[model samples]
Target chain A: MTDVLELRDVHRTHGDGANAVQALRGVTLTVRPGELVAIMGPSGSGKSTLLNLAGGLDRPTGGEVLVEGASLGTLSHRRLSAVRRRTIGYVFQDFNLLPSLTAAENVALPLELDGKSIRAARRAALAALTEVDLADLAHRFPDEMSGGQQQRVAIARALVGERRLVLADEPTGALDSQTGEAVLRVLRERVDAGAAGLLVTHEARHAGWADRVIFLRDGVIIDSSGPLGSADDLLERTS
Target chain B: MSIRHGLLALLERGPMYGYQLRAAFEESVGGTWSLNIGQVYTTLSRLERDEFVLPLPENDGGQRPYEITGTGRAELARWFATPIERTDRPRDELAIKLALAMTTPGVDVAAVVQSQRTAGVRALQEYTRLKTRQDKQAQDDLSWLLVLDAMIFQCEAEIRWLDHCEATILRRTRTARPAEQAQTPEPHPVRKEARR
Candidate 1:
């Protein structure tokens, strides 16, 4: 199957000449259907820059980014926004829900904005909420729910229309450990169901859910691990 | 991860023989820790000598069961009540290796850090996968979950340390550029092979 997301020799530099800081340096990556890729790095390590480029929110100064096989650099602004809404889903650290909107409405907003009927949008939104096991809470407002519930609502919003590429930046950062794991479990279930996931997190515990991990430093991928065929080797040796 | 304590905790419910104890132990930990019958028997004998348990009459199957004594009950209760301290852990071999790599001549400290980080991340990923699979497939066992959590947390800590080590080395190298330039710099690719 074709990759859902791909970044080829991508570079993003901020500012001009002497003040220019390279946020991404010739980084290449790919996320396929059912694959969850994690980016791990310290602060100012270009994690967000890479994620932004992948999501088409920021353009790379060099090289190409193809989301669902469409080169983002070649698309028009209108087309890109369409792709962002229809192809890629982003879950932020903050739930990013409007305080006044109830959970189902928050999720439906994206589809409604994309020109679907409000009734159809709401039906799809409830289905998405059910995917996250929050169908019963769909009527609750973001303020009425816990942090984890709100994050799930954000996730429901992101992937409401069966978006194949999910980009998350510390989606679990604000919640407690158990709640965070619950949120990740939802993300993992989505990825397992064939949505490619790209997670940017400093926490290894959270990144552990990914099928692969890319370690970034000084704006470059310093290391990436293979199939982890040695997991049994590790546990056996330790025991 | 003391098997003796584990056995005592299990025996608290009822008397169990060696084979039964080993099976129960493996089951509780979700088979992460392998225990042969010898280890189980040895631990039982030790517990017997320590007066923490009493040997019961042989069953019809010729298996001699052991029951936890009152002292063993108290010990198990104490173990459960007492939080494990960091000092209880074994010496960290990864930390020692990184420290040694830093001081050793011609050693690529960055490579060392990266390799360790890769391994650390791999282990963490494995534990996470296992935890998810087990949680999905089996009835939830708190002990098994706790064991997986311990491994996951340890892996996370090691990766974090490796990250810190790499950052510190990079910062130090940038600040002490002149000195580092005078020392062994990374050899050119062509020259590196030629040197060997």
Candidate 2:
């Protein structure tokens, strides 16, 4: 199957010269269609950096990032923005919804920004919301919805249109346990329906939604394991 | 999780032979928990001995089925009515490990905490994965879903506890260090300088 998102020896360094901090040091990963890969690591382990790079919000200083077989580094600024708006979806810990927009409008924003007609965008947004079982709340604003509901709207927004790569950073960080699980259920459903996902989370329970998990430390990939692999093996090596 | 109660509950529905009982129990729990036929037979015998169940006449196939007794039905009702007490849980090895690590002379308590946290996280991941697959395959299996949810919640709680342990240990170490420094005599300036 084609990879929905691929990072080939990707490196991102902040600042320059003596002040340079290598946030991601030659990290490589691939998330294929219908796959959800979880990235887990300590703070400053480049989890967010990796997500940002995948989502085209940040550029890698070295190597390549490809979404849907198109190299992100080769794209022009305008083209990259278009790629992000149409092909990549992002769910942040904070939900990142515009307070002024209703749930459906927030979900439709990406499609609209990508030049889809407003009517078409709204229709797609409602469909996405319905996929997440939030169609009834499509008219509600962010503040009007519960944290779980807002996160679901965020997921619906990410999943709207033909966006095949979903990047989530601690998407459940702000919700209660039951609500967090509910959001994960929707994310898992979306991935199972053929969208590839890269979820960066510190919580293992949330990562359990993924088929595989990659552990990072000091900006390096330390270990990767499948759902059935014994986590004790990884712990022994790390400790 | 309780095989005794599980068997009784199955018997409540209808009489079933050993293999049937085992199959029903496994099915109800979504195959997440497997049961051995030998264990089932052993439990059935014990139940018969206790008058909680009675062995019925062998069918044409010669398979003897066990039927729940009136007392068994009452017991099942009591089990359902009573909440499981926390005291009934087994000793927590992780908690004990952390407590011992704090007092052990050569143990790296932080590493211990880290390892436990990693294991907890992994278990949580595995449970969640199971839940996702199970939900997709058997969306209406409430018994299995509940079992999976219980494990997920417990694993989450364990990770949280491990985090709490690490933070508390760090705080205690920080507070204790100054006192230890005050009690220890300062090295002679010449010796300290030579060591440096």
Candidate 3:
């Protein structure tokens, strides 16, 4: 399958040479359709930087980023934003929902930003909300719903349309374990249904949901590994 | 974690012959631990000797079922109430390997840490995958779910410890011992850029 997200030897440095900090250094990764790749590292390890570069929220100082075979490096600012709005879905720790809007409206925001018709956007938003199992609360405001519900709304917003590449940074940071797992389940389901996903989390348990894990250290990927060993191997070894 | 306690717990549910007990044990734990008939019989014999279970007369199929005794009930209750001691676990090989790597000559400690972490994360992911599947089941099955959670938490803790070991080792190597005061010349000091 063609990769929905690709970063070829990507590098991101802040400030001038003397005072520079390389947030990402020569890192390369790929997320194909139906794949969820996790980025795990301590703070300042370039996880967020890598996610931004992947989503075109930030440009790489060197190397290339391609989403769906289109190089992000060469896209115009307007075109890039359009791609970000149209194709990329972002879920952050904080729900990031507008307090004034209802759940449906919050989910519809991304589609609307991409110049989708309000009615069409609402339809897609409702479908996305239903996928997250929160369709009945479509008219509820952010404050009215719990954190998990709000986060699911944010996820619905992120994946409202054909947004194929979902970039989530600590998306489950604020919820309890059960709620957090539920949120991850939704993300995993989306990925399993053919969208590619990139999850940035410090929690190893959350990273377990991904097909592969990339460990970043000092702005570089030290190791990338496939889904952990089978559950049986663990029991046998430990026993 | 003990087969003895596991058998006692299963017998507390109801009477079962050696074969039935083995199948129930495997099915209850999701087949993570398989018990042979010999082991089951050995444990049952031990349980019978200890008066924790009473074996009945052989049935039509030559199956002799056992029931949990009052002492067995008390033992199972105690097992449930008492906390598991950390010292009860087997020696962690990763811990020993890392300690040896730090002290012994010519060991790339960071490499050891990374490789172990790779395996650790893989196992952690698998537990999470199983946990996810378990969550979707119509039945709650609390005991099995808790079992999965324990593995996930322990795996997370081990990985965190490995990360701590790597960081501590790196810091000490860089700060406490410079090349000037080094015991000997480095055998194969890995350059950071070379790894990229």
Give me the candidate number with maximum DockQ. 1
Per-residue lDDT value at A108 in model 3 = 90
For the second chain, the TM-scores of the candidates in order are 0.84, 0.86, 0.84
Give the per-residue lDDT digits (tens) of candidate 3, residues B1-196: 7899999999988999999999898878776777889999999999999999999999999899999999999999999999999899988887888788889999888899888888878988888887777778736687777877888898889889987887787777788777656656555456555666
Q: Is candidate 1 or candidate 2 better by TM-score?
A: 1
Q: For model 2, what is the alpha-carbon lDDT of residue A108?
A: 93
* Error of model 3, residue A126, in angstroms: 0.8
Worst 10 residues of 1 chain A by lDDT: A225-234
Q: Estimate each model's TM-score.
A: 0.91, 0.77, 0.92
- Candidate 3, A127-182: lDDT as tens digits: 99999999999999999999999999999999989989999999999899989989
- Model 1, DockQ value? 0.48
Which structure is stronger by DockQ: 1 or 3?
1
Residue-level lDDT tens digits of model 1 in B1-196: 6889999998998999999999998888767888999999999999999999999999999999999999999989999999998889989888898889989999999898888788888888888988887787875587888989988997888888877888888888888998767578775788888989
Q: Give the per-residue lDDT digits (tens) of candidate 2, residues B90-174.
A: 8988788788888889998867876666666667777776676677797788887896687777777887777677667767889
State, as a TM-score between 0 and 1, how close model 1 is to the true structure.
0.91
Give the Å shift of residue B110 in candidate 3. Answer: 0.8
Q: Rank the candidates by lDDT, best first.
A: 1, 3, 2
Give the DockQ (2 decimals) of all models: 0.48, 0.21, 0.48
Candidate 3 residue A62 C-alpha distance from true site, Å? 0.7
